[model samples]
Target chain A: MVRFENVGMRYGLGPEVLRDISFHLQPGSFHFLTGPTGAGKSSLLKLLALSHRPSRGLITLFNKEVSSLARDDLPAMRRKIGVVFQDFRLLDHLSALENVALPLKIAGAKNSQIYQHVAELLEWVGLGRQVDAKPPTLSGGEKQRVAIARAVINRPQLLIADEPTGSMDAEMGLRLMYLFQELNKIGTTVVVATHDLGLIKRFGNPVMFLKDGMLTTRKQDELPSQFSRDGG
Target chain B: MMQIIGKSAELQLEKDVSTRYLPVVIAAMIFLAALAIGGLFSLSNAISDWSATLTGNLTVEIAFDPTADLDKKVTDAVELLSKTPGVAAARAIEQEETLKLLEPFLGRNAALGDLPIPRLIEVIIDEDSAIDLAALNEKLGEAVAGARLDIHRPWLDKMVLLGRSVQILAAAIMLLIGAVTVIIVIFAVRTGLIMHAEVIQVLHLIGARDQYIAEQFQNYFARLSFLGALPGLIVAIIVMFIFNFLVGSLEASMLPPLSLGVEGIIALLLLPLMVALLTRFTVRRVVLGSLERMM
Candidate 1:
C-alpha cells in the first residue's frame, strides 16, 4: 500500500516536477498509471518504488512513513516491492535464470528453492528454453520476460511495472497482463505505468491518470474480458 | 557447463574498462613495494652482521714513539697488550696490511716510501673481560710510549645510524606507495561504480543491500590484488636473488652479499595476501561510502 499527500518532488533545486500531489493505493488494488511522455510517470513510479524522497509532504508505503524511515531500513522495506523496469534492466553478464534468481538470492533463499522457483517462473514467462541465455543474446521480448520474472519471483507484496508490455508482441503482452492479473488475484498490489491504451482498454482495470504532475483516478469503461484470464 | 552455484557480483563488473586494468596496476605496485621491503631487510641483516664482527675489538695504535723503528714500537705494544689481564690475544699488523687499510684514503698504487704511518696492533679482547679503560691506557702508555687504545665506538655508532636511517627511509617509501595504491583503488572503484550505475539502480529497486552491491566490487578487486601481487612478489624474489647472485659472483670482500632473513622473506612471501586484504578493505570502504552518498 502506498499513500502520498501533498507530495512535491524536484531534483536538487530544480523547479518541482510533481507539485501538490496526493493519492493513496489500497492493498491488493490493481491500477494502470497513464501519462504522455515527460508527464512525470517515471518520476512518480520512482517515488512509489522508494528510490527517491518527496521534497515536500508526507509519503507512506505499507503503513510506514517513508520520509521518516532511516536510510538503512529502506532496503528491507524494498524487498517487499518488486519493479519491472522499462528498459528490462536484467544484468547483461547474468543468464536468464540467474537474473530471475537474483531477488531470491538477495533474500537469502536456499539454493534448491531458488532454482525450482526461478526455473518454473521463467518457463511460465515463455523463457523455458532460454534459461541459460544471457541478456545480450536474448531478443527484446525475451529480456522483458526475464525482467518481469525477476520482479515477481519473490512474490513481493507490491508489484510495479513501467511499460511492461512495450517490447513484446500482442499475444505475449496479453499473456503477461494476465500474469499480472493472476498475481493481483493472489493479493499483490500492482501499479503499471504505461501509454499502452489498447492493452489498458482490453484489460479494463481502474486507471490512475497523471498530467503535469497532478493525478486523477478513474474506473475504465468495461470492455470484453477476452484477455482477462483471472476473471477480474 | 558452469559448475559454480551462482554468478557473483564481481562478474557483473568483469567487463568494465577500469576493472580490466586493475590487476596489472595492483601487480606493478606490489612488485615495487616488495623490492623496497626486501632491500631494507637485506641492509639491516648486513648491518647486524657487520656490527657483530666489529664490536668486541680493541685496537692499540702507536700515537707517537721515541724510537724511529715503527716495527719495534708495534712489537712493544703487542707484548704489553698480550700481558694485559683482559687481553685475549695481541699481534702486530704487518706493514703491508697497515698500508692495505690505508689504501682507501691513499691511492691504490700510491708510493709508500716516505709516507709517515703509525704502527697498528690489533687487540682481541676476552668476551667477559672487565678491563678498566683508563687503567689500560695508562699501562699501555707506560710500557710502550704513545700507545692509544681505540674502542671503535665512533665507527659503530655511524654504522648503527646508517642502518636506522635506511630502515626509516624504506618504511617511508613503502607508506607513500601504500597511499598511492589506496588512491588508485579508490579511483578504480568509483569508475567501476559509474560503469555499473544502471545495473545498480535495478538492484537497488530489488532491495539489494549496500553491502551486497559493495561485495561485488570488493571481491573483484581482492581477487585482482591477489593475482597481481603474486607475480609481482615472485618477480621481486627472482630479481633480488639474481642481484645477490651477481654480488656474490663479483667475489668482492668489501661489498656484502644482499639477502633477506627468515622474517623478511616471510613478509615478502605474504605480499599477495596482504595486498588482497588491502584491496578488499579499500574497495569496501570506498564503495559503501559512495553508495551511502548516492542512495
Candidate 2:
C-alpha cells in the first residue's frame, strides 16, 4: 500500500538523513525495520506517517502521490495510517480512554460510539481498568499500551509503530506483537521499527535494515545468528 | 460533543500560567471600548436634540439704549415679526424672566435692575413655510433700531461641530481598543501554540485536522473574552449611570446625561458577544496560520 523511490530527506539546509531510500509495502504485509541509533528510522516513519515532506523523490500511499497531495487532503489520508510513537506522546491531561478516543473524535465519530470503541480497545490492550487514569499516573508500559490503543482505534489501513515493544516486558511485548499480527491478517500493512534484534528474530517478519541513511532488505533466514542489537 | 466556547480539552490551556491573567487584560480593554461607545452614542443623541430644538426657531434681541424706550422697541419688533410671512407667533420675553435666565452666570442675589439688560422677543416660524430671515432682520432693524434676529445658527453650528469632533474621537478610541484586544489575543494564542507544540504535533500525526485543533484554541479564548467582556460592560454601564446621576444633581449643569438611545443600548448589550466572536475569529486565524507552518 506504500511505495518510496529515491526519497531523500533533510532538516532545513542540513545534510540528508535518509538518502536514496526505496521500498514498497504490499497490502496486508508485515515488516520489521531495524537500524542503529540516529540511522534515520524515525525520519522514515515520519514520512510514512505523512508528518514531513521528503527533500526529493516520490512517495505514493494508497495509489496517491504523497508529494502531490494537497494539504486539505492530508488529514483524510492520515486517518488511514496509524502511527505509534516511541515516546507514547499521550496527552498528559487526558485520561487513557480520552487519549485513545482522540482519533475517533477527530474523525467526527459520535461520542457514544467513540467511548464504547475506545473502552473495548483499551481493554484489549490490558488497560481496561486504567481507562480513567491519565498518562502522568500510568507506568511506562501502560502508557505504551495506551498509545498503541490510540493508534489502532480507527482500524487504519497502514500501521507504523516506532519501537512499539521497547518499554514492555517480553510477554506483554509478544502479546502486543500478536495484536499487530492480527491487524495484519485483517489487511493492515504493518511496519515496526525497533533496535531489538531478539524480538525481530522471534517475529520472523521480513526485515528492512537501515544504516547510515541507506536501506537494505533481507528475509528472516538471511540475518546472521550473531547480529547485534546495536545493528552491527 | 464539541462546544463552541469551552475548555481546551487536549491542550489543557486552562491550567497554563501564561494566560491566567489574559481575561483581566481583555476586561480592561473592553471597559475602555464600552466607554467609548457610550460617548459616541451620547454625543450623537445630544447633537440630534440640539438640532431639533434650534431649527425653525428665532429670537429677536433689542439692544439696550439708555435714551431709547426699550419696552416700545420690543413692542414694535414683536408687531413687525407677527406680520411677517412664515411667522407663527411672536411674544416678548419679560425682563424678570430674562434676568432669571442669566441668574446662573449673573448671581441671583445681584442688585436688581442696575445693569442695562437688552429686551428679547421670542419668535416661532411655521414648520412648512420658508422665511427669509435676512429680509425679516432688515425690516425689523429699520422699524426698531438695534433690533436683530438671532436665528441661533452660528451657535448651533459650532456646538454640532464640537459634538461631531468628539464623536469621531470616541469612534477612533473604539477602533484602537479593538485593535489592542486583537493584538493581545494574538500574542496569547501564539504563546499557547508554542507551549502546547508537542501535543499539537502529536495530534497532527494522529490525523487531527488543523481545524480540529484550532477549534480548541478558539473556543477557549472565546470563552475568556466573553466572560471578561460581561464584567467590563456591566462596570461601564454602572459608571455611566453614576455619571448621569452626578450630572442630574448639578444645579445648572451644561453637561447632558449619558443617554444612549435605542441603538446605543442594543450595541452596549451586544458588546460581550461581539468581543467573543472577535476573539474566536482571531484565535482561529492565528492557530491555523501557525499550524500551516508545521507539517
Candidate 3:
C-alpha cells in the first residue's frame, strides 16, 4: 500500500517536475498510471519507490512515513517493493539466473532456495533455456522478461513497473500483463506506468492519469467512451 | 551484516564485465608496496646495527717506542687508561694478534714477512662512560712512549650521519609508497564506479541505501588489496634474503648484512597487516567520496 498527498518534487533549483500529486492504493489493488512523455510519471514512481524525497507533502509506504526514515534504513524498506526498470538494468556480466536471483540474495535467502525459485520463475517467463545467458546476449523481449522475473522473484508486497511491455511483441506483452494479473490475484499490489493505451484498455484497470505535473484518477467504468480511441 | 556485504560485493564485482584483470592489478600494486616497505625496513636495521657497533669503543696505538723500557711505559699507560673515568677495560694486543689482523690486507703468503707491527691497546668503555677526549689525550702524553690515541671520533661522526641519511631516505620511500597506494586505490575505485554506473543508478533509483552501495565497493577493494599484499610480501622476503646473502659476502664496514632478528620478523609480519588496513581505509574513503557526489 502507498499514499502520496500534495507531493511535489523538483531537481535542485529547477521548477517542480511533480506538483500537487495525490493518490492512495490499498493492499492487493492494481492500478494503471498513464501519462505522455515528460508528464512526471517516472518522477512520481521514483517518489513512491522512496528513491527521492518529496519536496512538499507526505509520502507513506506500508503505513510508515518514508521521509522520516534514515538513509541506512532504505534498503530494508525497498525489499518490500520491487521495481521493473524501463531499461531493464540487468547486470551485463551476470547470467540471467543470477540477475533474477539478485533480490532474494540481497534479502539473504539460502543459495539452494534462491536457485530453486529462480529456476521455476525463469521457466515460467520462458527463459529456462537462456538461464545461463548474460544480458548483453539476450533479445530485448527476453531481457524484459528477465527484468520482470527479477522484480517479482521476491513476491514483493508492492510491484512497480515502468514501461514493462515497451520492448515486447503483442503476444509477449499480453503474457507479461497476465503474469502481473496473476501476481495481483495472489495479493501483490501492482502499479504500472505505461503510455500503452491499448494495453490499458484491454486490461480495464482503474487508471491514474497525469498531465504536466498534476494527477487525476478515474475508474474503468467512468472512462470517457472515446477513451478507447486514444492513440498509443 | 557480513553476508549482506559479501552478496552485494559479489553482485557489484560481477556487474563489471571489463574489469576481469582487477585482481591482478591490485596484487601487483600490493607487491610493489611491500617491496618498497621491506627494503626500507632492512636498510634501517642495518644502519642501527652499524651505529651500535661504532658508538662506545676507542683504539690506542704505541707507534714508536725506541726505548728498551717500552714495556714499562706501556704498563704506565695501561694504569693511566684504567684510571680514566670512561675506560672500563684496557688490554694490549700481542705481536701475533696484530699480524693476524693485518693478514687480510696484505695477502697471507705475500704479507711483508715477520715485520714489526705497532703495539695496539684495545679499550672498551662502559655504557655510562662520558670520556673527555682532550683530557684523556693530555693524560696519555706523559704516560706512554709515542702513544697515539685514535678515539674514532671522525669515523663515528661519518657513521652517524650515514645512519641518519638512510633513515630519512627510508622514510621518504615510505611516503612515496603511501602516495602511490592512495592514487592507485582512487583510480581503481573510480574505474569500478564508472563501469558499474548503470547498476549504481538503478540501485539508487530502487532506493538502495548509500551505505549499501559503498559496502559493495569497500568489500571488493579489501579483497583486491588482500590478494595484492600476499605476493608483495613474498617478493619482499625473497629479495631481502638475496640482499642479505650478497651483503654478508662483501664484508663491507659501511654496509652491514641484513639481519632480521625476532623483532625484525615480527615487524615484517606486521607489514601485510598495515597494507590491508591502508587498503580498507583508502577504499572506504574513496567509495564514500564517490557516494557523496551521488547525493
Candidate 4:
C-alpha cells in the first residue's frame, strides 16, 4: 500500500535531512519506524502523510505516485490516510467531540451523522465523559486520545502515528498500541514512528530504522536489546 | 451567543487581536466613500436643474440713461419682442422687482430709485422654435438703444464646468477609498493567516480543502466590512440631512440642499452589501493564493 524509492528530502535549500530512503510495505502490513533525535523520523513520516514532497525519487501511496499527483487531488488522498501528530495537534478551542468530528465535517457529512459517529468514536477512545472538554482542559493522555479519535474517525485506509504513546502512561501506551494493532488487522496499513525500544520489541512488527538521513529495514528481532532514548 | 459577521469557526478568527479593529478601519473608509458618493450624486442633480431652468430663457437689459424716457423704451422693447416669431412672451420687469433682486447685494438701506440701474425685460422663447440669439440681440440693440440679450450661456457654462470638475474629484476620492479599503483588508487577512498558520497546517493535514479554510477567512472579514460600512453609511446620511437643514434655514442661500434622487438612494443603501462582497472576494483570493504555496 506504500512505497518509497531512494527518497531524499530537505527543507528550503538546506542539506538533505533524509537521503536514499527506500522502503515498501504491502497492504495491511504494520511497521515501526525508529531513529535517534535529528535522524529524520518525523521527516519520513511527513512524506508518508502527504505533508511534504520528497526532493528526489519516487513515493507511491495507495498505488499512485505522490510526485505526479495534482494539488487538487492531495486532499482526497490525504483523507484516505490518517496522521496522529507527535504533539497531538488538536485544536485547543474545540471540544473533544468537535475535534474528532472535524474530518467528517470537512468531508461535508450531514450534521446528525457527524455528531453520532464522533460520539461513538470518542466513547471508544475512552473520552465519552470528556466529549465536551476542550483540549486545554484535558490531560495530555486525554488529548492524545482525542487526536487518535480524530485520525481514525474517517476509517482511513492508512494510519500513521508519530510517538503515539509519548505522552501517556505505560499501560495507556500499551492499550493504544493494541488499538493500532486492531486497526491494522482490518486491512489498514500502519506505520508508527517512535524511539521507544521496549514498545518496538513488545509490538514485534517489522522495523524501518533510520539514521543520519539513511534508512534500513529489518525484522523486529534483529533490533538491539538496549539503546539510548535519543536512539543512539 | 450571536454569530458575528464572517466568523471563522475552525480557525477561531473571532478571537484574533490582529483583526479586532478592522471594522473600525473599514467604517472610516466607508464614511469617506459615502460622503464622496453624496457629493457626486448631488452635483449631478444640481447641474441638471441649472440646465433645465436656464435653457431657452433669455434676459434683455436696457441700459439706464438719465436723459432717456426709460418707461417708453421698455414699452417699445416689449412690443417688438412680442411681434417676433419664436418669442413666446415678453414682459418688462417692474423696477421694484429688479430692485428686490438686488436687495441682498445692494442692501435694503440704499435709495434704489435715485440710483442709475438698468431696466430688465424677461423673455420666454418657444420650446420647438430655433431662434438665432445673436441675430435677435443685434435687432434688439438697433431698435432700442443699448438693449442687450443675455442668454446666461457663458455663466451657466462656467457653473457646469465647475460642477463637473467637483464630480470628477469626488469620483477619484471614491476610487481612492475603495483602494485603501482593499489594502487594509489584505493586510488584516495576511496577519490572520500568519497568526493561525499552525492551525491551518493542522487543518490541511487533516484533509480540509483550501476552499474550506478560505471560506472562514472570507466570511469573517466580509462580516467586519459589512458591519463597518453600516455605521459609516448611517452617519453620512445624517450629516447630509443636517447640511440640507442648515441650507434650508438660510434666507437666500446659494448652496443647494443635498437631494439624492432614486438612483443615489439605492446606491447608498447597497454600500454595506457591496463592501461585504468586496471583502469576501478579496479575502478568498489572498487566502487561496497563500494556501497554494503550502502542501
Tens-digit lDDT string for candidate 1 (B1-56): 12111224624666677767777887888889998888789889988876766656
Per residue, candidate 3 scores C-alpha lDDT tens digits across B203-265 of 664446666677777766666666666777777778778877887777555566566666667
lDDT of 3 by residue, A1-232 (tens): 7998889999888999999988999999999998667878899888877667888999889989887876567778887888999999888878999988877876778999999999999999999999999999999999999998988887889999999999989998999999999999999999999877788889898899887888999676555444233321
| Candidate 4 chain A: 10-residue stretch with minimal lDDT | A223-232
Clashes of 4: 2
State the lDDT of candidate 4 residue by residue for A132-219, as single tens digits: 9989999888999899999999999999999999999999999999989988999899999987889999878889998888999867
Global lDDT of model 1: 0.83
Flag clash pairs in model 4. Answer: B6-B219, B6-B220
| Native A-B contact fraction in model 1 | 0.69
Model 4 lDDT at residue B103: 94
**Candidate that scores best on DockQ:** 4
Q: List all candidate RMSDs to the true structure.
A: 5.1, 2.7, 5.2, 2.8
- Model 3, CA-based lDDT: 0.77
Task: Report fnat, model 2.
Answer: 0.71
**After best superposition, candidate 3 residue A185: deviation in angstroms?**
2.7
lDDT of each: 0.83, 0.91, 0.77, 0.91
TM-score of chain A of 2: 0.95
TM-score of each: 0.86, 0.92, 0.78, 0.91
Candidate 1: chain B TM-score equals 0.80
Question: What DockQ values do the models have?
Answer: 0.59, 0.77, 0.28, 0.78
